[model samples]
Target: MDKITYDGIRNFIIENELTDSVAISLHPDSFDELVMDYLDINNNQIERPFEILGIEILQDSTGSVQKNKVNILNVV
Candidate 1:
């Protein structure tokens, strides 16, 4: 998985014309995952346009989860 730099994320948001309401809804960690996945699909090394299919939260019912798992779906 590639790492999404702060600048890369900023550029993506700007290009997409994402409003504050939409941007604020995204989890901070999910942003990186979303960016990297988008890059892979487009075969690009930098930020570009993409659409979010959905955002999912995968949690452990065992009550031992140290961190939450978030899946950012970009395609069906």
Candidate 2:
């Protein structure tokens, strides 16, 4: 599957209000698995823009997760 784009996720978050009242993203370091873990749609829809970023998935030893830095700056 194609890696989820940053703009795609940001747009989804704004439109669906998924981030509303949600303090942190549930994203993990293994972002690929997160697609199925959080999204409720079928396989065909998994790659769509509606899926939110699971940023919090990358947790540290202290159980605190950092913000998503992968595509944040569009360095790639």
Best by lDDT: 1
In angstroms, the error of model 1 at 1 is: 8.6
lDDT (Cα, 0-100) at 30 in candidate 1:
49
Write the residue-wise lDDT of candidate 1 on 8-54 in tens digits. 45555566565433422234454556466667766866422333322
lDDT of 2: 0.39
Instruction: Provide the lDDT at 48 for model 1.
Output: 28
Q: lDDT score, residue 60, model 1?
A: 30
In angstroms, how far off is 6's CA in candidate 2?
A: 0.9
lDDT of 2 by residue, 1-76 (tens): 1433445455555665553334233235535444554454454454433334532222123334443423221111
Candidate 2 wrongly placed segments (more than 4 Å): 23-76
Clashing pairs in 2: 27-54, 27-55, 27-57, 28-57
* Model 1: residues with Cα > 4 Å off, grouped in runs: 24-76
TM-scores vs. true structure, each candidate:
0.30, 0.27
